[model samples]
Target: MPAIISHDTGTDAAESLVYTSQPPVYTYTTSLISYALPPSQFVTPETPQVAVGAFIFTPPGTSPPKVLLLRRAATDSYPNLWEVPGGGADPEDTTLLDAVAREALEESGLVAATIVEFLGTVEFGTSRGNWCIKYNFLVDVEEGEVTTNPAEHSDGRWFDLEEVRTLAVTTELMRESLVKAFERVEELRRSRGISDPVS
Candidate 1:
């Protein structure tokens, strides 16, 4: 039997994986949907690989702090796997910020009002290739309201860090890294003498 993945926020393991719409066969000129490399191109040992992923957060009358999560659309390679909002970096993207901004707009339809800080980078393997260096960031949304494109995501939700940790759709490494990111955010806030409304 094949491995089943859901990418769903909730725990409902399916017989197949869910993913975003198919990545184009050719890289697009448009920054939003572009690929790291054209499907026909191969990355040689000399070729460097850098990708970006984001942990977008919103403060919604906090009971628990919530971050945006995207459900992977079904696909042959990575059928159903829940992941942070991100994708391959474009050749034209000179900085990680360029890639992060483009991906957030394409995937979540929310623009980063302010780039709070760089969380940290992580190396993760995917079915698509051997390994990728993921650039992670914490973004403040220009407007919290989301306008997601249905073709890319089945559903979108704001999950508290604890709730995210409980989801089976994601990996343990991701949960731990994000929880740490949240802790750092709280620390930064406190150092500035800003208080969490709940406390």
Candidate 2:
């Protein structure tokens, strides 16, 4: 298991808590990543219907890094729209991070290797008239092919930052999240003295 590291913004408020893990040396395991606690807001939801979204990037050496996105099946809620791999957290999930890894695997057949950063969260009303809060994270997955589930998603593709602007992403919040993810990716690369193709 990778060491879990977290930082709080010196506040007892729920939204101030942020959890992350130290960068891991890629290894294959059933428990791919570990997390401490999700923000109180997500865990204490009145309905306990929290969801998780993952923003996975291509391996470090891939020039012009891209993010994986899956197109929803026509029968789904956001029919035919492109979005990151994610869904509602299940009771069987040990932690919110587990939900992240599970959703990625079930929806896109990708194994999460590390929980890089907490992107943020979004809350919206569901079709059933209940609010759903989704915690988004930046994740690094093991090297492998992507096989999206035909029932939940119709197609899956890696889109560079430029190409993301051209796709019909699920929602405005999701579009903003993608932009923030790209910015975060560039920051991470620069911090490690890696050259960014767009820079």
Candidate number with greatest lDDT:
2
Model 1 alpha-carbon miss at residue 112, Å: 1.2
For residue 148, what is the lDDT in candidate 1?
A: 59
TM-score of each: 0.68, 0.78
Once fitted onto the true fold, the runs of candidate 2 whose alpha carbons sit more than 4 angstroms away are 1-35, 38-41, 45-48, 197-199
lDDT of each: 0.57, 0.72
Residue-level lDDT tens digits of model 1 in 1-199: 2221111122223322222222211111222222323422323353346667777765533445667888766643344556678778776654456566667778887765434456676776766666766667665555545555666666677777667767645567777767876676666555555444322
lDDT of 2 by residue, 38-103 (tens): 423356555556888988887665678788999999998889999999989877665677677778
**Candidate 2: minimum summed lDDT over ten consecutive residues — where?**
3-12
TM-score of 2: 0.78
Evaluate model 1: give its lDDT.
0.57
In model 1, the Cα lDDT at residue 84 comes to: 72
Clashes of each: 15, 0
Worst 10 residues of 1 by lDDT: 2-11
